[model samples]
Target: MALKQIWEETNMKIIVKDLSPVLLQTKNVFEVADQKLFRYGHLVLPCLSQNYGPTYFCKLEKIN
Candidate 1:
């Protein structure tokens, strides 16, 4: 349900170096941001990294 909604809204292409599947699974657990507050033409990734607590890594493209 959430995935469908995400696909419908915007493109989600991110790169998490050295990130395991466990981290990937954890990454998806994000509450949708308020559109009014957030800027347009953007993709937000709410993540929990070992160094960062509840961080956001916004990506607009897929890089190698």
Candidate 2:
């Protein structure tokens, strides 16, 4: 599913490169942000390098 679809269905807000307490998932791993956040996924991959690469998978949801 598309990111927008996921957001609408899950009612979650996701901000790439923005620090927040939102949920983030990558390659089956889900992480709850406590600090800085980065953008990942298909679109972000091209701009990323080997040292700092984008996550292959991602999922997010609201806390409250």
Candidate 3:
């Protein structure tokens, strides 16, 4: 999580997998956390730049 924040701060692109299930299963948690952290504060809005890479793969063999 700290690495992710650093990357975001440096304006690097992030590739997160599908989170539909996570969101569906943690709606209450999301709401509570969001309310606590983002209540009247600054936020870093993402930009739609054309330089993002593919989504992160959990298990994929890399060829030498």
Q: What CA root-mean-square deviation does each model show from the true structure?
A: 11.8, 9.4, 15.8
Global Cα lDDT for candidate 2: 0.43
Any runs in candidate 1 off by more than 4 Å, and if so which? 1-28, 40-53, 62-64
- The residue pairs in collision within model 1 are none
lDDT of 1: 0.42
How do the residues 8-63 of candidate 3 rate in per-residue lDDT, one tens digit apiece?
67665544343344545745433222323432322222334633332222222222
Please give each candidate's TM-score: 0.22, 0.24, 0.22
Model 1 residue 42 CA deviation in Å: 6.9
Q: What's the true lDDT of residue 10 in model 1?
A: 58
Q: Report how far residue 17 has shifted in candidate 1, in Å.
A: 20
The stretch of ten residues in a row with the least summed lDDT in candidate 2 is 41-50
Candidate 3 stretches greater than 4 Å from native: 1-15, 32-64
| CA deviation > 4 Å runs, candidate 2 | 18-64
In model 1, the Cα lDDT at residue 39 comes to: 41
Residues 2-61, model 1: lDDT tens digits = 444666785774443432333446445543334345443223434455333333433343
The pairs that clash in candidate 3 are: none
TM-score of 3: 0.22
